[model samples]
Target chain A: MTKPAYEGKQPSFFTTNAEFIVRSIRHSLRNVETMIMAIVLPVMLMLLFTYVFGGAIDTSGNYVNYVVPGIILLCAGFGSSSTAVDVASDMKNGIIDRFRTLPIHSWCLMTGHVTASLLRNLLATGIVILAALLVGFTPHADVWEWLAALGIISLFILAITWLYAAIGLVAGSPAAASGYGFALLFLPYLSSAFVATDTMPSWLQGVAEHQPITPVIETIRSLLLGGAADEHAWFAIGWCLLILIGAVIWCTWLYNRRAGRR
Target chain B: MGLAIEVKGLYKRYGSHEVLKGMDLSVAEGGVFALLGPNGAGKTTFIHILAGLLRADRGIVRVAGYDVTMEKLRVKMSISLTGQFAAVDDMLTGTENLRMLGRLNGLSAAQAAARATELISQFDLEAAGGKRVGTYSGGMRRRLDLASSLIVPRPIVFLDEPTTGLDTRSRRSLWDSIQALASQGITVILTTQYLEEADQLADRIAVIHEGRIVASGTPAELKARIGEEVIELLNEEGEVSHTLTTDGTITSIQDQLLMLAQQAPPNARVRLRSPSMDDVFLALTESADSNSNKEAKRA
Candidate 1:
């Protein structure tokens, strides 16, 4: 009853993932609001912090240089939330079930989602960087510093996107996923991403110095503006890697457990 | 010549609720097998097990000669599942969705485009294919969803409540597509709550009640199980009981029924009609309900 042509031609694992990646990328491209949110949120934040709050804050050098790095990391956070919403929708909409019934591996689909998010984050970061340059934000990064900053930002996006992907799986709806994701967008405000830590209350300064986003923001700011980045650079990479590894493990474990039970 | 799907000793439960208890089914290739059940009768559960979507607590399910659990990949390769909901991507256009599935299922670039074009015309989605599915009508979405599942020439297809929530006209259109598939020798297993749909489309029908098949045979054979003549009695509150009798000819039966209606309560009505798939379904499930109720009283 089967055709000989379609037989024995199971799509290779990598090919399957590549196809899913293409599908996810297509969906992301069509979601105009999420695309806008990805670029606009950070750009809006850049303009607001550069103009509205630039007068009140004090940085040793140009405020754009101080704020651009922070806004880029903030952009990554906002963009990862879109990953959460996408995952939640796929789960609730029966598309995941269709994927499950197919011969394709579940990890391939998850990887596809993460890959699309990485591209979105990359494009969003590029837009912010270009916008920052337009506003006279100069990056003094040498070769190593440039490589290190780009590596750190990519890792940061990968780490946060994986974490939100897990959150999306557990979320009941896309709205709930986005609601939980809203917390990620707000994490920057509590860190040195916006105002100087010293200007904050002494207690808040302690939190601002110790939180995860602070180190990454400080490291990028140092790299972009030509300063010593020894401790901050390692700490930022460590945090991003730590989150990425931990999240990948957790999401894989959750997927296996759910697949087993479901 | 061989069975497209074969199942035995299927059992599933959600805590205390047993959905499919030691149930079994076999479906030959190249025909529509309609599973009819009232809500919670485990029709969906059975299809899920066959499609390798839900794990059965105990069963040996073989689809296209592949064990549903042990050789799930093989089973999946030979089958396509269109779930109760339209599972196609809302963000993609109808053509894009079909092309995406074709590529995901391992067709080459040109093959995918050709297949997508073929399905677009076959499903009559030429105009709707360009529009985002988020803006599609329910009928258009369902047609596209069905088309997406047929990216390859799978020997078997599982359609779970495929016509659910659609208007009559849309449902008829979907029915025609199912008929078209069967005509191409594609085996179809469809779970439906509509008896008329079963009667109209199924070569064979199974009535499921309380997680087990209460009756199975050709649609006419199933109706014949409840006898040819059905006497429907409606009381004042509009509660109806359909009973089959082997009493004399149709006219004689109607004569006796009219006399019985005389002693009945006010506004009572009695009608004599041929047994339909609905009658067979109701008869089997009603009997199952009463038998369980009796056991409950005894316990």
Candidate 2:
């Protein structure tokens, strides 16, 4: 038998980070069944809202098209929470401390966690897109435009995942991470991004119309439904970038602080 | 020899409670230094500070020639710490966990895989290397945890109560691994409640009480400080029985009388004498308790 490669040798930072990422991906992949459930729940919600409550609302275009992006956004939001839960679970399990002692880049932890979430969100996105297509929802955007839209949505998911990951890292328990997820899922629905802001009270409408989700939804709707790019697209892209940057900084800071105190 | 870890007047507080109160320690290079303390004596806290995991409220700490505060990363690079709990991920196999840690420590993918295989065999975990750690026994998890620390080849390692809950066989196995690491010139700082562990493994032992080192010496030195033998006497039929040996001399018979009066049964009592690490621990800790009590009353 060949001697093991690590025999009488020391490991460095690059190898450790690669291993961290690979292990994280493998761990997430093990939950393929759970990922399917995560995808199905939102798709079911989208179907119920569009078919059962379709006539109740007048979206002008197909309600499925109007709500598909919302459902996808909801899926991303919901999926990111599990990322938090898993990260929190790892913290509680003492795995985080183990990583702290190793000679790896501290940021590799956040990267591995957020990357796993991105992979899951991508899987969920594919499933949601397929479900939408099966329900007669069509995208009129060019191939490049569609790809750009996917990229934007992915960036948005990455941003949210990091935010939730930070929450998980700081939360006292895994249950708290889940509680945070529950609170986050309701944000998109309360905004005009999902339903028309006019349907709400005038005072409430102003707030809902200006919320970040409103612009994000508006951007996705325009890109997919063959509409002119509104100022909402710029607003949405700006919102994503700001959140991404803020989340990265905040999560990195929290990780360093917490790890230092361990 | 150069010091691997130096702590001076270290203090830690959580809210109104003090965990460590002006503790001082120095561990020499390539030495096995054991910190022996009862539960809640701040062994964990002291180890945390050395590992660069926690900051002291007041004190100076240096590890591997680097100041812990100003050169945190450099200090971190030279040390590895394994806390009371096994820190392996349950979802990853033993080999995978080692490989991940290896990669994080700067190994390439192929090198990490190769290193993982080597660690697996070194830890005697080959049969279970491919299985997820969740399926492994507690001993296996602990071995994997220790294996993870070796990935970076740190010069100093901190083990806080490393054998707290292990079965006797597993504990012995771990002790061997720890000894092997120390023999390779790695400075090991260990904390444990088991006095025997300290007596057997440590080149030098520091007895900590209420977060302060009350006694520091080699096992034999501490034992010699406490004398060769401790004798306990019992009274039979209301007759006070006494025995004396040059082994442990008492200042006066009154001292023995008072101790027998406090411990003896009204009708009968048994007496014995033995050389033990437990006795030395009791004497040192008792002195510490009395001193601290006096300080508290003064305050």
Candidate 3:
């Protein structure tokens, strides 16, 4: 009997999935000049916040320490929209339709895209971190705690990146993806990132306190600062999980529907 | 073994408009079947339904003896489709695209690489294989697209207007590739508006018009149906001469032509013939349109 093509060549789950991810990362990283500009944006923001506006914010401890993690998160959030733009551009350019005819798993395309975005976000995050450290801001968390914080934040970023990707898939064009991203950026600011939710009006404060970003930021802050654990961590994880599941299901349905039409 | 592809009473609708109304077709294994139709004739819909990309409203569709709906994966594995535009990633090189597809089709890494190289050489794309697809000319991109489809040697292939935008040389190259595949016993179902494409490549041709199969036969059979000679007479009086010349008077003309041929033994002989495929196409569409118009008026 003739052996099948996959015989003796079965890839491990990680390797199979990682191959696409690596391809996407390589494609994204090829444009190093643009990424350098993206890296600079966060570093410049960190400097402006630390030097110019640090005195105005009434944080008792170092302002850089208080804002560095938030800036890193912001950088991740801001830069993630490019992933959506890339997806939308691909859709517009007939690449998605080409991918549909291939034998790859449907989710592989999105996985590759999200992985690339995460890699770029990590690079941008590193630049911000270096800039913060250069200005004497040190992470208070232990190594494990910092790792844990990083893990949670990465998960959150991945979840939201998928959501943005779905938006991009549905958006009319790449410009629309950027427009949607601009709308999403306001959510983090409304949360507990730049200001306390208590400072807002009661109605706005209620929304900010209960929204998904608030718990996520709170959880990360607690982990990084060695503060008391809050119930918001569970809520944040639940929200991320829900969003991840819902986005995947909805996007897959749309993709299948569109594929069927073609 | 009943048929390579079988469709029975396939129907599809979009919104309030019905695109396919009970279309049916079957193709024997290892045959080059050409589907000829004008635009909006629902040929693409039929192909999509058979490919398992579209679900028919009501029908039975099977590819390579597997039900398209229940055995979608099997059906998919048995066939490959190439549409009008080349479906390839512009960022990736030609070799990379083929290798990626090979891996997706379950080839080992080494196997994928070897298969990619083989396809590159086969398609005469070796010189351009290392360059990104974005830099490839139209013909090179089309060849790469065709190469990508052959990544996993499928038994049946669906090509929808594959040579629409190609230059003559590129079109001829594709025709050669298609013939090579078919000669290897791969069943091919192709749709083309270019009549010559159908005439040259298709062993059998089916012309579809207004969601219906207007005519089907071997190219010789279809051309034979058109008879041997077409005489074009110039009418000096325009519409009046045309109306008078074709006014249900063919019986008399037929008799006269027979009598004249018998009486005159000349070096040159004139024989009357039926219309060509282009003529048949024009007549069918024109009649279908007028019939629908009359029905609308009556309604």
All candidates' chain B TM-scores are 0.90, 0.88, 0.85
What are the TM-scores, per candidate, against the unseen true structure? 0.91, 0.90, 0.87
Name the better of 1 and 3 by lDDT.
1
Candidate 3 docking category?
acceptable
Worst 10 residues of 2 chain B by lDDT: B238-247
Off by over 4 Å in 1: A1-8, A59-61, A198-203, A257-262, B232-244, B247-272
How accurate locally is residue A149 in candidate 3, as Cα lDDT from 0 to 100? 80
lDDT of 1 at A3: 42
Each prediction's total of clashing residue pairs, residues at least 3 apart in sequence or on different chains, is 0, 15, 0
Against the native complex, each candidate's DockQ, computed on alpha carbons, is 0.46, 0.48, 0.32
lDDT for B241 in candidate 3 is 17
Comparing candidate 1 with candidate 2, which one achieves the higher lDDT? 1
**Models sorted by lDDT, best on top:** 1, 2, 3
Kindly report which residue stretches of model 2 are placed more than 4 angstroms away from their true locations once superposed.
A1-17, A59-61, B234-272
Write the residue-wise lDDT of candidate 2 on B58-168 in tens digits: 999999989988887788778888889888888888887887676666666687787888889999999999999999998998898888888757789889899989999
- In the predicted model 3, the residue pairs found to clash are none
Query: What value does the lDDT take at residue B21 in candidate 2?
Result: 90
- At residue A251, give the lDDT of candidate 2: 85
Q: State the C-alpha lDDT per candidate.
A: 0.84, 0.81, 0.76
Better of 1 and 2 by TM-score: 1
**TM-score-best of 2 and 3:** 2
